[model samples]
Target: MTTSASPSPVLSPEHLARAYSYSAYRQLITTLMAEGKTTGTTQSEALTAYAQLNIQRMERLDKQVQVQPELLAAVQGLQQRYVWLVLTEGWCGDAAQIVPVLEKIAQASQGRITTHYLLRDENLDLMDRYLTNGGRSIPKLIVLRADTLHEVAQWGPRPAAAQELFQAMKAAGATHEEFAEKLHGWYAKDKTHHTQQELLRLINEMS
Candidate 1:
């Protein structure tokens, strides 16, 4: 007799409850900044400084990032609800650059999409499952069907072009400061275009 395979596990309600909503996540960062701290188990002055800069990045993106017209239209047309569970840390520069844009897309979805932010260090099991090149990367978006909580799609860390640049920099053995400056410079110039295009394609494919 033939047997069907078991369904994959879903995030438990208790775990979901522990995840912060976008606004709550922002508030948490704000509070941490006031205390000269940041998300994650290990904290240091450098991390705290990074967190402060990230706060500025996020705030700017929150006010400046706009969903492309095509992307906005696609999100409005989504037939099924989705949950965007994002793994992030306040001190992560890339997360600060991307998460606000995600919030914008979710907001433009007209209640079709809900987003939750979970600290990566606190959710190692989940992060481990979605590692990028065996590294636990922040701002990893796991798109899940709302009804079944089954993962439908995932995107992360950075857009294709940005990822390519990152890989190149790492392979060349660029220092953290050097690569970071270049990466954020690229982000500043690209202004989330590649990110939106990629998400738009993912949404179209899933739809």
Candidate 2:
């Protein structure tokens, strides 16, 4: 009598569309633009549109497409570690792109994903303690194995945004076309990296 598990999120399209569109996505655009030396919402709309375009392409992929083999193994290993908590803002594009596929992977592995939100308006403690690298990016995934005193991973503690995406997508067995489309699309628009949590996820997915 084994019960089949669903993905941790169990998301609905309408719900995801709204949350990703207005929340995680918009914030990601704001952050990417702010990463530059200048600071202003002067081109906010353009950034939003650009980010949305890339996300939309991914969402259009048939959700039923089998989870990639590499991604499946990673999900299994992470699940064994205990509930992996994903702390992200709803408006982040990284959250939108990376999380959805991870969600897909988790579903296949018996649904062991846990997530939280760290909005700019509230809850910066975890970021201060865990992700002290730079601006606490959304989708800053944190993996905790319970036996350790410290957290597992933080995103973008380095350079080369495209490589991060390539690695993550590659882990999921995402095709060169899939990775290239998402990577170049964001790169052309200017972008950032996945957190350590997500970086592991990318590797796990690619396996």
Candidate 3:
């Protein structure tokens, strides 16, 4: 007799219910910053400061970042609906840089796509499933079928070139500040082109 393969793990409705909308996530960070706090269990002045900086970064990107025409066309053409559940934290520099762009794409989809945000520290079980290099990474996008919530595709942490630059910096033993500076610099110069291109590829594969 033939046997069927086990189905892939799916995100439960309860978790999805608890997840934040992009606007809510941004407001949460802003409100927390006013209170000298940040998301996650561990609280620190440093993390709070990072959250404050991230608020500004996200705000700027929300206004400045533009979704490419081709990517917009592809997303708009998708016949299937998707839910982009993102793992992130307010204090994460990479998340601050990238989440706004994801929001823009979702907006352009005009109901074909919906995006949700869940703090990495609070969603260890989900985060554990999508670990990057065996470590929990923020701004990881888990694309799911809107009907069943079964994950269809995933992208994360950073784009290919950014990831490569990150590994190189790590290999060279660059400090957090050093690597962060170079990474954000890369993002600024790249103008979300790489991220959009990668997402476009993922969308094409899905279609």
Off by over 4 Å in 1: 1-6
Total clashes in model 1, counting residue pairs 3 or more apart in sequence or in different chains: 0
lDDT (Cα, 0-100) at 197 in candidate 1: 92
What is candidate 1's local distance difference test score?
A: 0.89
Q: Order the numbered candidates by lDDT, best leading.
A: 1, 3, 2
lDDT of each: 0.89, 0.44, 0.87
Q: Superpose all Cα atoms of candidate 1 onto the true structure and report the RMSD in Å to 1 decimal.
A: 4.0
The 10-residue segment of model 1 with minimum total lDDT is: 1-10
Please estimate how well model 3 matches the true structure, expressed as its whole-model Cα lDDT. 0.87
Candidate 2, residue 131: Cα displacement in angstroms equals 4.0
lDDT of 3 by residue, 71-162 (tens): 99999999999888899999999999999999999999989999889988888988898788899977898888888777788888899999
> Which 10 residues in a row give candidate 3 its minimum summed lDDT?
1-10
lDDT of 1 at 171: 96
In angstroms, the error of model 2 at 53 is 5.9
Per-model TM values vs. the true structure: 0.95, 0.46, 0.95
Q: Is candidate 1 or candidate 3 better by lDDT?
A: 1
Higher-lDDT candidate of 1 and 2:
1
